[model samples]
Target: MANHVYTAAALAAAFFLAPANAQASPQAALPSAEVTTAVDDVVARYELPGIAVGVVVDGKVRHWEVRGETAAGSGERVGRDTLFKVASNTKAMTAALLARQVDAGLLAWDDPVVKHLPGFRMYEDWVTREMQVRDLLIHNSGMGPGAGDLMLWPEPNHFTRDDVIAGLEYLKPRWSFRSRYAYDNTLYIVAGEVAAAVGGAPYDVLLRREVFEPLGMDGCRIGEWRISEAGSVASPHVKRQGQWIARQDGEVVADMPMAAAGGVRCSLDSMLRWTQTWLAEEGDTPHSGWLSKKQREAVWTPHMPMPLTSRMREWNKSHFYAYGYGWRLSDVDGTAKVAHTGTLSGMYSAVTLLPELGTGFVILINGEAGEARTVLEQVLTKHFTAPGQNRTVAYYAEDLARERAAPESSAARQSSGAPVADARASAPRSIASSSELAPWLGEYRDPWFGDVSICPSDSGARFESANSPRLSGPVFNAAGRFLVDFEALESDADAWLDFANDSPDGKKQLTMAKVDPDADFSYDYEDLHFRRTGECASQ
Candidate 1:
């Protein structure tokens, strides 16, 4: 009953805050009452802390609205300038900065990345030599999904952009070069470095001069230090104990190093400018002349095709899905829709551009609700298609209901943040004893992730990653193989360390895999090939 009341109150608050004061001056097409109802319904269903959506048509922001509070408990209302981490949406901006260099005849789209940054390398020498600047922006780098992400995801480290470049040779390729599309973030970081090298400034500085300043998006910023200094920033929120809790802090990776891939902080006000710039440029209306139409077309042109799941095929009715430089390209209802979704730790954001309609919208949320897609879809369908065509909200609501009602198991509970037999769990019970396990105890290293040591800790034998300190957890035997439970992580993404003696001298090498079926894909434990560097003192 208390939960019911909380839900009602939350919905009421959202309703009250639905039509915020932040409207696009000279609003072109305000969200109708129907759109408001749909947006409010989705927000209530997800119990999001807050969300801001901006709709722009023909280079004019038709509508901009903020719903919900700055956070779950904070009574502070989210205003037009409330800054939110715009994660991978930052990628498009990076591509734009690089495009400016191309516009100046400083860099070419097909120029080999190695030409710009000689130290750049991939797992394969041929791939490293053949990789073009365009390849860095596309997801067809032949690496697996989220490969090398462990270097930055879940925690911050002392890694620099140079470290990211140096670590590339170690990431094993899951596909042949340009053979298929597999989304990755590491290469984008490289792209940022390339832009910085060619532009004679840091990535963020380059963006400011090329993109932000020209558009007058003063509130938009790149590094964490700048984000902290921003006037008003939305607190990132996560659901805990059936309540939305705000994390009123910024992620370290969102600062400078990883900013190239997913770190961008901006508000609805600045994002309006950014989106409007893109819409204007799409219509041959130049703002700062940073990019030529040919360059813009190159960025929007589909570079590589992405496979569609059966559900995705049905959802957008997309015949094919491909990647533009930094944008995702697809056709919806026979109209080309260029889009991208951004997900930080707690913030979820999406930007959609319909060049054909001269329409685009950006939805920024403080919570990681999957329903952000539904909200944006509803808005898009409402404008582009027939009146009764917006059934995405219902479909997503049903999907969430089904997910919530599924029976719970150990794996499911662990995946959903229930306690696991973590590092704090009881010590090892194997008959093989500590001496038998000591052989596996050593400092293991991966090129991208740096180091992960299997060493003695207060909790017993543990596995810890150098780049991601929170990855430290209990290392115990399970099903005859050594396993690790990342107690600090809410998810059940445990790693399995398999030792082999394929060397001529019978030297052992450790290869890790996220054996848990429920592990987060970003964990990418399978990407690490750790050779035992030195023995550790046994626990």
Candidate 2:
């Protein structure tokens, strides 16, 4: 297939010269056959259950290519109107809502968080007092990445917004306030509460009235709403034993405690409109009115420096990367790119914007297909950033093959004597006898997260959480190390249970960490510090 790369200068000139109303007109050309072919190849290669791709050029949705079933065999085809959870992409919209509040003179970015939520508090007293509203959006809170996320996920949990807010004071910081960059979702939840406190309405209500309604993003849904009323919604899927299985049935009737951080369902049409709002220039009627010129700039401006990963360096030759309010700001191949990716269980979404060329694209997938998203993002981005280069699915497939075949790094080899596959195959799968599990049997408690009970089960030992019910599972022994194989398959976050060597005062304490290092950071099992409080309750 021929590469349909457009030069940045040429694309920018064409976009600027086009009539203002051209954005809504159907004059823009559709995506090239190459783009469609690439999307098909990725879907086939990754076996993604459903995907919705939308491209916006010259501030208009120029093309859309939706394919596959809402669930693997449900036969409900994904359409432009089919809602998929955009996850953390909702953060940008949350930031926009705060910006609207700022525009209305209701809140300032630098205002202390306590000014809005009087009871707001962080781990450190001084840090809590000094923390500003903008600090909540940017991920420089000194907390480790995805800290305290266990309270928010494995959904249908009992944790509430107040529980999340109150838990903040107990989560110990990894570093001093504003000392370095570390991504966090809990703070964004706090930001949402701040918006609600100032806006005199719930976060979802404020989002609907201030952003969604004004921007015509009618298909987006948040907070508590029945699945039946959701119209066409995509089910989240995960691959197990080489088969794609639906996890959640797209029912979100219960309130999402982390809704501000990552719980918004949107259709391709609505996402395109949201993208267009950001692509619009200052004084561009509805879009510009969404936020003042200053706030618009504020949301996109880089606030904290992000470490350049090997992927970013090699893929886009990106020099620097940082987090803005709700977006990531970076220069990709000499063109400024503002973007954010949302990942939740089996749902994934990415929104990329090239402001200089007035172009952006949204990729929403209702499956565990992060690799597919990466391949598509690079292929789409390279169309403008390095148009001359043809990086297709085949290219990425070969690249990934090479990466997989390469030997593990020295550091990796040293960390684990044997490969993960080898270790899993050789290790014992279950506890030997009930007597062996006695030392670890107890009701343990963490400060932020509530209670976890380890008790003898019919099979062996069982692990259960009080606040997070989905964490219940059988305990497995891997090379003398204890691990919890969560019964909730959708979570895919099995964690190792490590006990402290010395029990001061005869009290046992344990720490948990993910068995798979690459599991979602939100698993955050390593952040948990559980102390054996007492014997497990009757059951």
Candidate 3:
């Protein structure tokens, strides 16, 4: 796993000097202090629990540093090699693995997924047959963003790769198949299985051999088991009571089933090597051969166009935004920018590449704040180009303000046996008691997410979901609906379970909605359709 290491002096020698035939700008080649100051300032202002920053300039690690602690409570300072969950950044690696299979002639990018894995399917038969391997990498599967994330988040599930594939058949599409771009993680799980079927090895095993070993990523590992064993990993934290607090060990484990989509963990050392490999002038490299020029180009080429309504474009001064294989492709200051971000419960990271300038940066944060992108913007400004005077800084400061104002951030205040201020202030005057909820006791089921049982307990009733025991909690009647509190989760929001006899048979159906508007959009409970089907409800 060992590869060449370029020291600062060696990097200066390799990149600052031009060939005898060509000229290079010495002024532009020297390292600048602007990038370091910007990164440090962002971390301090955001109160990020821990952060690791790595910059690859001209195929070498010109800047690498770790600042802050492994956890909020622990005073242990993070080392350069400390492992942090890269989350959805793993998608690019998955795409890279697929590229390798293509290079080996084991699979084609446009081949229908069914050709590689039998029994693979979606809500519609046509979609199942026409869904190509490339479709899996892009976000145009017609399923809404984070459509089925509840099945695997917060609490790890007993589901396997087969279970994930089976659940897809029941997931109804929010948009016509392939009509629009909606990010969905479930398809990536299917893509990982396709790699297994075509590569003749398990998904994790295939990646370790084909991607990690070849790239000299000695500290990198995929999935929960591998990550849990990786020593000296930075502990995840969440902002609570206006301070960062370490997440309990019981809830900090990675979602193993969703590994393909967002479960790779590594350090800055490995990430810098990865950045250099992708920024290779020519795609061919003796150290890594899985991604060819064409393959690399294919992933960076826009596969689905983005709506650009988001603030990301404004901050980066991008003309348009679109999704490539596993990367987000756009033009910042008329220069091609390729990047992707990753997020778990309390971990956030950003990996960006500037192919035109032969520069790239990887930022890993052990907290939930998405300031990585903000920090990267500053780094780009100092190294390649600047956005504008005071423009990016003002935008980033506003973002930090929003994160602090969010209701979930006052979690510690709510956890102290007090009603959430926003919830209490806006709640309706009339409170429905347990007696009013008598008609709602039943077992309900969703085709994709399985079942939930609302059974009578001493106080009110206990609520339990099939694959999500961590979401089990006490249910109370409030605002004419049943409010279930998931004590196991970090947030203080209550899940509102609304019931109605809208079914043709008048059998009563239940659908869930998050009462807190500030709740993370990934908790897409509103997508579920739960129908009553048990003797308890009949009585």
Q: Which candidate number has the best TM-score? A: 2
Q: Compared with the true structure, what per-residue lDDT tens digits does model 2 show for residues 329-403?
A: 777886678899999878999999877767889999999888899889888888766766867887977787888
Instruction: Write one digit per residue (lDDT tens) for candidate 1, span 337-397.
Output: 7789888778888888765556778888998675665655645554553344555466666
Among the numbered candidates, top lDDT falls to 2
Query: Which lDDT values do the candidates have, in the order given?
Result: 0.73, 0.83, 0.74
TM-scores across all candidates?
Answer: 0.84, 0.91, 0.85
The order of the candidates by TM-score, greatest first, is: 2, 3, 1
Model 1 off-target regions past 4 Å? Answer: 1-31, 224-228, 250-254, 281-288, 374-379, 390-392, 399-436, 476-481, 501-505, 537-539
Candidate 2 vs candidate 3, lDDT winner = 2
Candidate 3, residues 213-283, lDDT tens digits: the string is: 99999778774453346666887887878998776454245447888898788888998888888877653
In candidate 2, list every pair of residues with a backbone clash.
Answer: none
Tell me the spans in candidate 3 whose CA falls farther than 4 Å from its real position: 1-32, 224-229, 248-255, 283-285, 310-313, 371-383, 387-395, 399-425, 428-433, 535-539
